[model samples]
Target: MKTTTAFPQASRSRSGWLIAISLLLLLAMALISLGVGPVSIPLETVWQWVLQRESQESLSEFTILSSLRLPRVVASLWIGAALATAGVGFQCLFRNPLADPYVIGASSGAALGVATSVVVGGTWSVAGFNPTSMFAMMGAIATVGLVFVIGSSRRGTSSLTLLLAGVAVSSLANALVSLLMFVHDGQKTMVILNWLLGSLASSNWQTLPAVLVLSTAGMFWLWMMARQLDAYSLGDIASQSLGLDLFRLRLSVVLAASLATAAAVSTAGVIGFVGLIAPQIARLLVGTRHTLLIPMSALLGASITLIADAAARTVVAPAELPVGILTAMLGCPFFLGLLLRRPRTYSRPGRRGG
Candidate 1:
């Protein structure tokens, strides 16, 4: 006798309320982020600045609004959105909530690429490209490709196998990075350390286009795969039974997600936890439905990063903390709490629909 439990009506209603509340919270956080910084701006001034409304505001105020704060805020928004959307896609692909965008070794690959560009590329210049960004993208793609090849068996890819391969690749990349650091002098060491720490200090309008392109494409691609992702949550056999082409679906997701991640990391370095935490928060608000979860997660992720960036700038006054450090500091405890919550177990074979 096969049985299945549908969500209760009350549960559905509660989910709706949670989603609404989450959206409100995101908007509030964004506004708060724009207002708080090393030099605080009045809410009215921020509003005017955002709307391009000129006021009798001082030069310092204009500098803070236009030159310093605006680019960083925008970077936080897009970067966070990219990571969160990618996280959702990755978690769905692996069928593991603990899985993150970095699980496929993209982060390590990006790091290696950055290291190579800094160490080998004289002056870190290449005709038109920023060598660091270019190398990071290349490393990310190569890492994904390697993981795919290593994880595939005669039957096709196995989640367990793919995860293990990623772990191996990540370890190798980390070792290489460490070795490079060990051999470098003080100046080189400082450059590598700062890059690894992750900062939004370098953001500008010039970097926005690439981030927008990658993020928009990735989000659209993931949304298109919403049904397939839902099917996968039911298990491999269930997805196959539903006419989903597992290999093709997985490839598309990985490609889209990896590209988005690579673009973001190339510009911002590794900003951890946006992908992992954003989706979980979205799920808590919107249940397991991918359609709502994906976009909402993107928004929430942006809000979280923007808020964290604001805190980083304000906490030290003229000195700044790495945005990545702030994210991990917040995300780690939340992750531990989730682990201790003891999630429900679904029987393997019983994953098929009623």
Candidate 2:
């Protein structure tokens, strides 16, 4: 009995350590990111600036930190966390390790929306959201809604059915975006293309509030569903038998995740793989308790995004690669390796043995 109790306690201790380390890593990455851009600042200086302590850095350096890098880093942190948290939710909801926030056509729909806005050449703003962001959010929500409606049955929503529906919608939306890009003028096309490739170059204090609010709400909502999601791992019938409303859970999760994805894609432009990679890595580190998994995933996601964003800014120097491209470059290899490795083993929490 003591041995049995010791094992669970040991696992908990390890998870706690991992979570603490993840938080520290995320903080370190955020600081590193703030100092990484053109005209680099020192780490100590970055820390001083963050803490509002006097520093020898010039006013221009301070301006760059405050006006530019800070917001972008903050955006990356929250957006990554949101995407990763949403990823955990979707993965549990779907019972598929490969499932991500964008698995349900949110990225494609947001891309289409942004592409449409760029083509239309609008300068409108509503409640801190530009025309592009507004359209992106609308597109994501609508696409998710469409997929849910099509995928859901009278009995309940099946993961496989929803997955198929998402794939179809995503393909259609991607096609539409491509068509728009092909038809538009070169300059506008380039704008849309850059956005589709995903860049945080545009993230600024002016536009971050809306993203923060939406993402926070979505993440918190999803976190609240942690128990339901955990119950789901017992299988759909078991979950339903436990007085969990399967339909409501599906709807709430899809909606919450869509909200977070829309906020992210609208700001960062369809960054992928953070959602897929972070959650899996988190599960590997801390095991599969949704309560721990969700927060650990958030930290890992934030750290990964910061690293990718920093690399995107500096890897080419002066000519920045889109962060999204960097993430894909990183993600694709990881994804293939995930498949080639013990995918079945990795998919389960705390049960690595075949």
Candidate 3:
């Protein structure tokens, strides 16, 4: 017993250090991102701006850093973390390797809500935030609830059934979105289309707090229930025998992940595959325990989002590409490669050998 306990304790300690190192790496990447772009400020200048100290840089540079760049970066960090954390929860909940917030159609639902707001006499903003964000949240929650209703029965949500339900619902949402786009004129059509592509260009200081708070709350809840999520990887019978309330635990996690994904979509416009790739990478590095997986995944997620957004903004020079496009470009190929590499592993699985 002592020997068995010692290994996990030692592994946990190692995982903690890995998280710390990853955090430092993430900070370095963020700082590098701040310095990158058309203006090409020095890293020292970026650091100086970060310290709230005056820099000798031009006023335009100052404005870009303070007003334009910082908020978008912060938003990316939060959104990445939120998406990744949701991926962890959904993966654990469904016990399916392919499960993700977007995979389950939560994002599609959110997109439909935003589309409705935009198409029906334009979107409204309160303070600085648009009505589309609120609509997206409601849409995501509704979609997730509908999925559970369709996929679950007296026994509870079946993982395979839930996946199928998500696909069916997603197709329906896309059809509705297409119908709305067709009804609108060219201008509104372009706007809706741009939104669907996903970008962080609209992020600002005023609305960042709401997304941050929602995502943080979700992460906190997942972190608080880490052990329960881990226990869930075991068969339901085993989990129940160990005194885990399968129903309540499943409900709470699904809600938390949906809320987080909604907040992210509202801010960032449906960036996909961060949730999937980040967790898989973290699990590869640190193994299966949720406590370690959650934070580690968040770090990698933020890093990946940061890099993708940097490319999105700079790759096209003055004309920016949507961050979502960049993520999809990177992730789609990686996903394909993963599938080709491990067809058998994915097909014959025991909780992904959790």
Candidate 4:
């Protein structure tokens, strides 16, 4: 028989080239995003504007580039990174490829919180207490706590239980949000709708610091746990054999994921699927190794959101569509394809790969 070593070597070489090309594509997309908008600007002008060089341009163009576009781009980058990190964390914790950040009801909780803040506080509270972000964070934390409690059994926590509880809590939260909408004053309904649909339009230097801090802290924390995450992918027995404390590992992953997600939702108001889709894309590219997987997901996530945000701005011109809508429009088909490919099975170390 002819030796096949050359084929394997060529395959590895091809995969390396593919990864390098994907990184280049991500960079190109990000640059393209900065260039396209309602008032189109050349890539060179956009680059100069980004570098703070004075262009012989109208004041409006300068303001649009610096004040509006820059903030949106930054927000999209961090938000996408946060969501993707959370998605990878959750999927690993549950050992379910289908698990996402919203699988634990964080989005619905944040939505309920935002709705309450806008409807109740905006209408009833006296001047000086805008609690929208506060309520949003509280709601997300509470929902995650509730899901964890419901999911844990006398023996331990089950991923299936966690998922089911999350669905229940999310459904209940959604119902409450609908009830609030029904009773909400006509004037505030638009505000509520916009909040749920999500946007980067409101981002500014004032709001940027919190997102930067939270996302940075969360991403760093997740990166630290990447090894433990890889161990867990081999299942509980495998993790224990590898010297990991299963409960502690799971707890840390869940908390880090929840905190990152809550921060993003509180800041930007429920942008979806950046988490779900980004990690999946990363897995397809890099396999299940968390060290490479986490960073790759962050890059992919940032790229996807940047492109989607650019489309949202240009597609509707002055009106502007929400970023969440664009992500859903793109993610749903890919998600379904993943589901149809195979039913994934979990396995422990020393067992045959399922």
Best by lDDT: 2
- Per-residue lDDT tens digits for candidate 2, residues 1-354, read 012353557777788888898788778778888999867888877877878887564667888999999999999999999999989989988888889999999989888888888878778798888898888888888899999999995477888899999999999999999999888889988988888888888899889999999999999898888888888888988988999988899899999988988899988888889999999888878888887888899898888888899999898888899998899899889867866774566455686555
lDDT of 3 by residue, 178-237 (tens): 998898899878877887888998899988888999899988888788889888898799
Point to the candidate with the largest TM-score. Answer: 2
Model 4 residue runs over 4 Å out of place are 1-24, 122-130, 153-155, 337-354
Candidate 3 lowest-lDDT run of ten: 1-10
Sorted on lDDT, best first, the list reads 2, 3, 1, 4
Clashing pairs in 4: none
Scored against the true structure, residue 122 in model 1 reaches a CA lDDT of 64
lDDT (Cα) of model 1: 0.81
Assess the local accuracy of residue 315 in candidate 3 as a C-alpha lDDT between 0 and 100.
90
**Candidate 1: residue 156 Cα off by (Å):** 1.7
TM-score of 2: 0.92
Name the candidate, 1 or 2, with the larger lDDT value.
2
For model 4, residues 70-109, the per-residue Cα lDDT tens digits are 7878888888888899999999988877688888999999
Off by over 4 Å in 2: 1-8, 54-57, 153-155, 346-354
Give the count of colliding residue pairs in each prediction. Answer: 0, 0, 0, 0
How much lDDT does each candidate structure score? Answer: 0.81, 0.87, 0.84, 0.80
Instruction: Give candidate 4's whole-model lDDT.
Output: 0.80
